[model samples]
Target: MHYEKEDWNFELVVAGAGVGGISAALAAARLFRRVLLIEAGPEVGGTGVFSSVSLICNFRDSRGRPITSGIHRELFPAAYTHYNEQRVPTYDELALKSTYQQLLEAEPTLTVWTGCTVESADVENGRIQRLHLQGQQAGTVAAEVFLDATADGNLSAMAGMQYEIGREGDGKLQSATATFRVSGFDLLKLENPDIQTWPAIHSLRLELLPYYQALKDEGKTANPRQSITCFPYPDGKALLFNSTSVLGVDPTRPDSVSRGMEEGTRQANELFGAICGHPAFRQARLDYIAPRLGVREGRRITGEYILTAEDCLNTRHFGDMIAACAYSLDIHSPDGGATRLESIPGDGYYHIPYRSLIPVGCSNLLLASRCISGTHEAHSSYRIMASVSAIGEAAGVAASLAVIQRKKDVREVRPAHIRYVLQLRGQFTEGEVERIPLPASPQQEPPVSVEPNFKSNHD
Candidate 1:
């Protein structure tokens, strides 16, 4: 919907229309609450779309059961329906973006404002009273509960909430990347005829490595990555290169991000040119580079409970668990070193406690993105799209319950209540469930169906 310049009021206001923000808005709107989702970008879809990261990160546990469901499944139904470890699961960015638009538009009570940003927040005591917005809709928006899904904790920072950035030591964050798509490659020229499988894709990368290495040895590029890393599209015709590594790019700093984009794009082109020397890519075209650089780490908002690396390694369960993450702690080095990956033990997943979503000392604000409280090591695991979607869904439910129960503080809404709602919505949940009377909303719309096809020529 087109946003007009005017002051607005909502039961819930979500900042950032990325995956997390969209999930939060949809969850709340499905519950019959008035929701406003604000995005600074021209369209929905954050890193997963604009950055064009093709691979769908792990959301299933070791036993192959999905730990992250709910809105995530709705967005990427192919991932859930076509579960195959042999084939590398992926989605086209444009297809996912279309799904986001469909689900969002189906929610009658949900209003999405693209090209809008939450500039500031009005805090009274510990609660946020109003949000001053800029961009397409430049005015104040008051809400009973506010969710910070800006990925960089922009809204939480504006609300005077505490946050941590980067790793503990020198505060160096994960290296950023400028991803790009490439098509028109001859599959018959490749040793692996089936590039859709993990083994085949790995083989393809190895096959194209000599060219990339030659470029590096000749000092034709500034990228620090030693090897080529690319994922095949679901159709197996195209590939999304997530190989370039740009160091010292901080999301909170605009100047640093701008410089990073320039360097990363340069690296992307050099890499693309090098790969063209391969027999399979001789006729391949250099598809458009991702508009947004893929930033792995950002502001880790201080919450009621700070999740730690030990908690994840131990696979600890929380009584107030709201979500789960199955992805490994994959950290792209800040200094452009080798990537570090450590998988979760036992069930291959860990719980994301509800306390981690509630910003410290804030009564009505919730962290609904990767900005949620966690150590640097822990953040690397839950920062993936699937986990972030679950976090956003849980936060939305918690926020709505706070308004519905008429609780003065968000803390008053019990985790059991949130879990109950989540389980009813077909999301995976554990622990005790509190059966409570939920008020029916007349504004609630029926579920919207999404296309099963995952291919897109969106570029």
Candidate 2:
């Protein structure tokens, strides 16, 4: 019923190694919290690395002022300076992974355990006491506070937390995509050598659609979505194709994901063959398919606040604001039709309340990813990487502050105090705060040795 090393303990434990989990660990460790970061895969980056999601969605207001700052800026430094509102936002996964490794290795208070997952959780009186980890290694870890950064709400669900999945009524989620990469395209074949620009990208897409359509007419492919949507690699040598959709794939169901992967790979290869006829792709070659499926929707953990589509459309501001999102409501069609896009009103952004990250029935647990409480429509907007990073940063700050303040219930920690720390770290915030006496800088925790298998070269 229970399994773990007895002496393992930390001030905070973060699950999953996506951008959200990494941000949470980075934020807390910098504040001198003894933190343990557990990831399921061998690699640190989640979908961003494994799925090769090439684009960086909008994180700035209409005039191009960043609404999601803090760790997000650290990951995508290009967004911090020389941000152009009209340029197509994108990044290379290889570069992002390198940045994550360097930044995480520098945090002395953070301990990373890759190839491990949160197999089970001990929840007592609405608070998490210990988490049982298994996969590459098995052990139990105890913590004063826990943050669930699993994009699928896996940790919360394991803790018996209530959650909603997919659309409100039919339970259909946005289709999953298996992205792929291609390189060695002859750039001289195109009007613009720099296809990374929005205009050049559109032009290239228009040039390749006819060939792809011909393959569809010939029944050579099963991809439902129209047109080829891809972005340039950072080096401008390769293209990351965010195409090949598979409908009704759910991450919580392993069988569904497996079948979806099979179908998605079929689509990826078919589309690749179809596009090879294009002038620009005549010399191109398929690199590889993503290791994991790119799931667009997952379990929305029930929190104190359930953000609504109306809130995003109205661009609502919260008195307990912890993070902000400026990405449009870009919902890919569940049926593989057209994508729906709705821009935020006025200031082109909306605030994410601290209450949304505080899941109900959990005293010392916080959500740090896209799984945070929100309607399917509302979740579609802030589920982008930039906002998720911001959410993780805020959740980390709240968890560490709850520890530092000696609070029995996480809700007892004042949002104003959390905002104070966030503001000091250069995160965007608008909530007014009462000046509370803060503790002196914390000394870094002594490094703890983990199982031999969990150690990385950086560790």
Candidate 3:
């Protein structure tokens, strides 16, 4: 091994360039912290760009309030404007990647490392002392704070933090999705006009059922719009796919994941080909395939407090709310269909406690992304790209606070002050606690044990 003893330095090193990592890097950079955003792929936006998963999720709070404020408020609304009035632009991976690059390039304090993979890290006293990354120029980087923004919690796993994968009884997390883009056709000419909503295609799928069944019976079959969702884009094109199907994948194993990506792409293409041949998409042609597989579920690190489904249903707001999530529990199945948990009556927003992002026993590392503390069901809601971005912003601020205070444990920060700062920056904050009136119905009583999908071994 070649050893050139050159000390690498950074104030904050953000691992992964998805929404979470981008948010963290931007936040730290704004605070004048020398920041490095490390991405394994050639691009950023994580699954948002890679999987071609469109839509910024929901930005409002439970009470119909705009919860995703701050940078989120800026980015999301601008995205809406880029599209026609009737359509809200699903975040295009390439567009967002350019946006990330442009934003960071303008900031002198931040540097983005694309096509870089973190091989390992040197840890001492519950902190990352040195990080070894391989890319065009293999080198080491040292940072005061490390943000675990990898969708699979790679940093948390490297640091030996507690976490869970898949489900408990079944050990299956959720279905992995493969998104595909199709073009050269007038999607606006479809029998059903509206393209954004899922239900828009429901009737159309039924109308095309006879032809689909005929193909299925002849062994020349293709899944219909019933399994696929199409969102409109500019021109005569659309993103015509959805994340469905659960494959038990071991993320730590490179070979296993590699196989999954190949197979997932094949399935997505098969679906695309079927649609292209069908009457609905006969004129359509394959536009582009996602560079990364859409992984809807993965390893979740056990943090100080696991956000629960009960918390989501109750619309509970914590004193130290890092951000808020308004998306319902959107759980897709291995066979295609999905089940959604209805939002709480009245205002349907929920707050994310800062404690959920702080891993237990780990002093210097914080988690954002799908791996943050939450039950399986709760993670389904919190795992959305929009919410992860918000969480990453909060984690970044907290990490900066740690550096300033010279404190190790994240729990040492004051929740009240954090909220004040976030609010001042235009982030959503819980103003006060309120109790909801329960129905008098006896069956409506709460369950004896209510836990999130991913439960932490810690208290």
Candidate 4:
């Protein structure tokens, strides 16, 4: 175990370069905090880029008001324009990746370390005193605050924080998918060339369902999805397929993830062939498969407040709300087949309190992504990219606030201060957040109980 001591010192170190991590890094960097964003993969986009998740799930309240407006809106501007609930909301991953790259490059205070994984964590007194990362750039990372944005809660788990995996019943996670793209479609035969609209997309999926059904009947494919689910690219030239579900693929198990990839790629090709006979897809060609598997569920780090299904079902409001999520409780059955989706009852939205981001027993750690403290059902609701990005942005601001206040513990930081920054950046929040004397110190509030199929992440 020969490793030299080399520290990449910063005020904040965000692990994982997914949408959440990227958002957090940007938020912190913009706040003039010396920040570093480390990602295990070669690229910065994480699942949204490599896994090619096509759709940008709705991030609006019942009145069709955009609740998640900060970093998410910055990432996908089309989502914020001319709000229409009837339009099929989808996004181009390439465009998002380009935006991330440009934004990261623009942040002079931010340093991004791609192809790096956290190998060891030095924790003492419930704080990450030191972090050793291995990859092309192997070194130690030291920060006053660290954001765990691995989506799977890799950083929190590495720091020995308590967490839960998968559903409570059998502890099985949602299935993984290997999305793909197809271009050169015969658009003339479809209802319209502009397939981005809700009507066209809905009609197209129904029209192509019989072919997919025939394949299932003939045992030519293994995808459990009922119809041909896909979304149009922004250019309207290609389609991103979010189909092909592979059960029993846990991100923690390297072997499981490896096997899932093979099964998923096979399923993608099988589905492609099954639908090639259709008129729209006759000349369409498979562009490429996603580089990473889209694993919907991950470790839910135990935080001060564990958001439960009840919170989402009741559409509960919070006094310390830093961000809001309007998506439904969409749970993809671990066993496969049809997904179970339950809408967020009344207002069609709920506030995500600051306590949910603070890990239990961890003094300097915070959840910056899909791995935030929540129940399995609640996790399914907020795991979507839109909500995840908001969580990341909030965590980044909180981490910077902690550093600025010189607070020894993250829990000592105030929710109102975080909300103030988020509000300044145009993020959504509601209820009474005690406008604390910030630029000074703020108080902490204790509390809270708080995907996809071939099931979309509409929550």
Candidate 5:
């Protein structure tokens, strides 16, 4: 294939247009920094959109206080406005994709390039100097600072950064999923008509369990999941099945991911067929399987501090804290058995220090996704959308500060300044916040109108 060559320069270049990348790009652009966001896919919205993971995982502490805000709240406002513990919080993928597009387009200093991948990186000493592009658009790109929001640490790996993958003992990863959406089910036929409530959804799952168990007994399906796991959509008319566990898939291996997708799709179909046997789902229609496989765990780049499970469960705090996570340590079994979930002990959240975002020995690169330095167990917790978005936002602010302060290395960018900016942006911050005056006041995020067609039923 012939490639067109072009040259570009920007103050910040974010690789991967997922939640993390989008948050990072938007944060920097809002600060009037020229930013470029590159995605390997044909469009933005990464796993949340393409993989169809419906549930907006918990971002609240044990006391029901939200620890994740800012960009994340903007992306899923209904999650906050309609908060209810009894109801499962979820977002429509199409609605979210539209929101991402609108927010990105509104930023004058931000440029988005889809169907593009960073083929290589030029490193001098411990800093990345330039990046070579490939795919739909080819070019040589240079940036003052780079954010590896690729989710799997693709950019960091290309920059020759050291990283670890999967669990330490045997290098096993979390099971992958091929989620699907279904509609037209008879709500009244269920034991409880309100599928939006946790109790109702749990009863619905139990009601459909027999058919799935029968399928397994008959040797008709290969899915190893023990139960039916699903969440109701915001409109309450559809259900998103997050079941179907496919093990042994690694993001680094293209063939493995492709095979995983195929197997996962097969399992989805099998489970859908089984679920259709239920009285409530007799006329249910399988809308479609997600276009992309949901690969949960990936490369964790080595940063200055590697967050451990001990720190997470103990609710550890750091002097350079830049973000926080309230989600549980959720690890889907690599052997395709039961999943392990452990909640945070104290305040139900732990601080994510700024050092975890800075890769060890790297002066200009920062981790903006689940790939940030952490052990396998700890990665399972903050890998959710909420914490990753907060991490991305912090990285973006730090990167912009590095450029504005004329700092030669990212280490010089103070966490206090990042926290101060984050607080100004309506994000939750802790510890001391040092005010840093900017050339211009940061632009306030405009209010985004909720989608007219979809409405949350939560009280």
Candidate 6:
């Protein structure tokens, strides 16, 4: 048996280099904890860079308010070289990589490991005693606190942590799209005066109609080209398109995910080629494809407190609010169907409790990203980059506190302390926003409900 033994100790080991993992590393480093950021991919910026998402999702609250704060709020505008009318800024993938590198380089206590995959872990009692990692010819290394920042919650599953992979009732999740960039676009000539104008969009759509008709004639595709979603790239001369939707991609299954990525890429090129022949895009050229597949849904580990759809509509505020989210439910179907709830009403603000970040029955483990506690409906809103970044901040801070206090259970740490640190670091809070004045309540009796439909899938 060729077994190599090595021991590496760090205050925190953050698995995955996505927004959540990166934020965790940044936050933990600020708290003076030694953090090892491990990523399965060869490069950083998990989906942000690899998937080439042009802009950050709704950074503001329901009332068109900007809720992100702390390192995330600062990192937002910095990630973009320019912000157009789309509300989200256009991000250069290369620039984003450099930004993450620069930000991490500024942290003395931060160590980054690209192409590193965590195979398994050893958990004693509630705390994770050691985590085994392998990558780029490097053997295994251990750590004190292990964060399951992987978008798929890979680490949590390996540690025997309970989680759900898809929607409970329907056994489905929002569709996944493969994104690609097109070059040779003329920002100066394009009629899109603003990001929303998309005047050239209709032109591009018309150009793709003939191609779609041909495909349908040949029995290649059932969907038309008008169903595509295009966003302006940072350079303004380029357009990033997300038209292909891969359904039934179980994130936990590597084979399924790999297949989804391959199909998505193929679909991207097919769309790109169709657009290239158009009058508006006749001069266009294919820019680049994503290095990582864009995954819209995955295993969402059930936590101690799961935020629900009702909570979102109510704009409920928890006593231990660690962060806030305002984005509405955006569920895209694999059948090329897209659904979006533009607003959630009620001031467009909702609180993310500290309890949601900490997993139930597990110690020394924190979930960031889409895996954080919430119903499928709630996950749609919370899965956005800004909200995930906030969740990462909360988890990172909580981990730092756990290490400093030598606490075993993550729940042992006080929520107030986490809130205090987040506030000090400039994280937004409901307290900061003054509640709108409401009319006085009348002294009237209310009737009680005789029937209750409390059996919910979230339970």
Best candidate, lDDT: 5
Overall local distance difference test of candidate 2? 0.87
Model 3 error, position 407 (Å): 2.3
CA shift at 152, candidate 5, in angstroms? 0.5
lDDT of 4 by residue, 1-459 (tens): 122657668889999999999999999887778888999988899999999998888788777888899989889888798557667777788888999999999887788988989887899988899799899778787889999999999989998999999999789999889999999889998866568787788788887788889999998887777766789887778889887899999999999999999999999999898779888788889999998888999899999899999999999888778888888888777888688888887878988988999999889999999999999999989998989999999999989878877788988777766776777788886653333333321233222210001211111
Estimate the lDDT of model 4: 0.85
Tell how far residue 332 is off in model 3, in angstroms.
1.7
The TM-score, computed over Cα atoms with residue i paired to residue i, of candidate 4 is 0.92
- Candidate 5 — which pairs collide? none
Q: Each model's TM-score, in the order given?
A: 0.95, 0.94, 0.85, 0.92, 0.95, 0.86
> Candidate 5: lDDT over CA atoms?
0.92
Q: For residues 1-459, what per-residue lDDT tens digits would candidate 1 score against the true structure? A: 454656688999999988899999999988899899999999999888999999889999999999989999999888999999898999999999999999999999899989988889999899899999889789999999999999999999998889899999889999999999999999999998799999999999999999999999999998998889999988888899999999999999999999999999999999999999988789999878999999988999999999998999999999999999998999998887899999998999999999999999889999999999999999999999999999999999999888877777888888887988898898988787776666576544333321222222121
Which digits, one per residue and each the tens of the lDDT, describe model 6 over residues 183-260? Answer: 776445444434433465555554456765565567665333336567776556677776667777787788988998
lDDT of 5 by residue, 231-335 (tens): 999999999999999999999999999999999999999999999999889999999999999999999999999999999999999999999999889999999
Expressed as tens digits, the lDDT of each residue in 102-177 for candidate 3 is 7778767788888988878888877778778899436888888888899889988887788887666676656565
Off by over 4 Å in 6: 1-5, 78-88, 137-140, 187-218, 222-226, 334-336, 431-459
Arrange candidates by lDDT, descending.
Answer: 5, 1, 2, 4, 6, 3
lDDT of 4 at 180: 96
Off by over 4 Å in 5: 1-5, 441-459
CA shift of 270, model 5, Å: 0.4
Give the root-mean-square deviation of each candidate in angstroms. 6.9, 6.9, 10.4, 7.1, 7.1, 10.4
lDDT of each: 0.90, 0.87, 0.69, 0.85, 0.92, 0.73
Model 5: lDDT of residue 18: 90
**What TM-score does candidate 2 get on C-alpha atoms?**
0.94
Model 5 misses residue 182 by how many Å?
A: 0.5
